[model samples]
Target: MPTPSLPHKPITVSIVSHGQLSLIQPLLGQLDRWCTDSIEKVVLTINIPETDLLGGMRWSFPVERIENPAPKGFGANHNAAFTRCATPWFLVLNPDIRLDGDVLAPLILQAGADSGLLTPRILEPGKSAPEAHRALITPVEILTRNRPGYAAPSVPSWIPGLFMLFRSATYAQIHGFDERFFMYGEDFDICARTQLAGWKLEVAEKLLARHEAQRASHASRRHLYWHVTSLLKVWTSRAFWRYVLQHGGR
Candidate 1:
């Protein structure tokens, strides 16, 4: 738990885990090897309904686990943990992600300049880089592109929430992700809010991370219901409606 040797201000890396105990070690190992000197603290938010096993786990970096009720959605859990972050930069990582050595440093620098929110290029597990980050979300983008037959449309501002690095001040100013969004669309909502608040959202193409996309919640019907409901809520928001009306939804 030694302090990270950072060049500028220390950044706090916050990871949100539901029940991916198997992936936690490897993920932390990669972070320690890759981000050793860059990250100051690694805060793990564990959704523990009763017992707290995270406290007993071994991690290579300075780590702390905060136990809380199983959250309604991803955004809610992250919002809960956001209050405890005191760093200039905060990294929101999923448990199933492994970072490349140079991934976060450049993103942190970009965010420091003008980007309020920055997400790294995400690669599917065991694969090379793929085009995962994109522009803002629209109903048509969600319906048409996300389906099997349709192709994803071009966007100017969308980025995956799997590995988001944001300015702590900007995150606090925007009040973090909307808690109403249980899971899906929360990142989109936050991006939209960032634009509305006059903050820049950037995709750091050079930074890369491998994502397994595996999660306990993603396998359940209850989780699907919450995801759909939250997505609809974000799509139907006033800002999104205006974008839809003006741009034809995609």
Candidate 2:
């Protein structure tokens, strides 16, 4: 029998959880099957120390759970997650995202220097901001995603962090997500930085994934504050305009 082919390097998968015990349980369950022999390592960061629900789950791959008693910002947590990763490719996944099939293998094979950032067609339940994938982060977009049906732009520039596959080198060139963004805007900031550094973002229209966003901001006043604050943080920053001018965005 011919020798089986092995991956050049294993892909690292990570998810930061903040009290999404219920939602993540199923997500991980689906991931258990999907990851199988393909994944090298899986790290699940428990932001809520009290909730170690993921600790009990039976993971298929070499999964590790980190306990963060005093959880930091979203980017900081992921950046922390990245420290333990030694893979050529890394996937920053959201806790609310569910996998229907294999999204990593295909995306990795298609991604390279020309397109280091690969995003899948994020199918959100209902009219839940599918337009987020094909957009440039702007004040209007920030408002529209939360409100829905407000005419999002057709141009594609950024991808949602719900499922972003990054080449390790490209991610390092952009220096990963900005630690400043606590809960939001990190996704937009990273994409902008990637574009500024001359890496193209590609969307896999056929490679589909599902997003089950709770819209916690809309439900809770605190998250709403963070959402609005992060929007302002991304747009008002000097880097935002620098990227705009360099990348030809208004």
Candidate 3:
């Protein structure tokens, strides 16, 4: 556990709400309570039109809202928000993520010169165990996931976008998430490119956050279609193969 560092506020958080303002409100409250000292401001993207519940609310840091004229994909929404970033750190946070304490301090303190992306251990609600980190993405890896004694790599090959904290320069160097990916596979794609560009993906294991999992693709046909198509795109991408060849798909 790290103490809150208030001398400098270096993080600019990016959160996109696809009509999940209810969830965003509470998440924003947690950030206000615990991370206000570390965060410069919050860039919230309202991907679809909704009631303006945040009109009179206040926080220690500024809350800049981007009301989209039309809905954009996950990468597009966050990429648009990045244009407003002026801090050293950029966080891509999910609306459902809840924090009990200051999670940003430890991550910021731990980031080395070569650290490109970092994340805290993500837990499901009421669970003590951390969520599984992902292995490298390939068609063969996907098809063989359920085989006997199959195991994901001990070191994560990719981090989910749900709670990625990026060095702003590293993100700019990698050119952010590929907009070609609409929703699902962009996380894996970005993580792969981040490592291929000679930067380390570090995890702050002592810090934790709870993710109230939405599991949207499970219930929505449209979302499921996007997930499948995005996986196909990742499997066919140059970045994926380059990572596999260079890193040996560890």
Candidate 4:
């Protein structure tokens, strides 16, 4: 008789809503359609007070909703959700992200023993090129990033927070995202820390997910302030500099 295959480790998904139920509705629908078997549960954190729209909805996996009394930062919301994660894999997904098919199966299959974090190739809606596959950040690179003829590194040092799948152990090892990063820059910090802690970051090249970019920082003064301040914090962080030194960022 043939040997039986081992059961796959379940994944718990974490999604934070900043008053964007319209976007989460479609994302939840996609997850329901494509990820029934892979996802064990979803920990949904409502960072801001919003009308209860998801109470009436039913899903294949349990949906644990967290309604915060006040708004929390991006990292704080996800970190709170992470505390509720009971699965082997913990996924942090942006509200605006859309899934067309089973993205989790491929990523889980490709993750090696050393893989700490993994993300699918993220692309903007209606665009062919990938977005947010970024090089290591440095003071010089930040100054010249948008200048004429600046080249990005061949290998990515960090994946954005839009879609990050963390092994539960790795997430615990690194202590999760720095809650000090109110809105932005936590992704880079977490990626840097993960690598510094001897965990490998992997990307599934063929698997694709679409991001409907909100670009809120471009329009909102409060968001822009958060973005700028977070960048400063990241630049001065020990993990960022340590990663740069170890990896030889140009």
Candidate 2 wrong stretches, greater than 4 Å: 1-9, 127-132, 142-155
Candidate of highest TM-score: 3
Which candidate number maximizes lDDT? 3
Instruction: Write the number of the candidate with greater TM-score, choosing between 2 and 4.
Output: 4
lDDT tens string, model 4, 1-250?
8843224547999999888988998899999999888888999888888887777899888889898998888898889999998888999999999988999988887788899999998999777787645777766777987778888766689988999999999999999999999889999999999989999999888899999999999999999999899999998888888887898873
**TM-score attained by model 3:** 0.94
lDDT of each: 0.71, 0.77, 0.91, 0.87
Model 4: runs farther than 4 Å from truth? 1-9, 143-148
**Alpha-carbon TM-score of each model against the true structure:** 0.83, 0.88, 0.94, 0.93
C-alpha lDDT (0 to 100) for residue 223 of candidate 3:
96
Clashing pairs in 3: none
In candidate 3 the C-alpha lDDT for residue 174 amounts to 94
| Candidate with the larger lDDT of 1 and 3 | 3
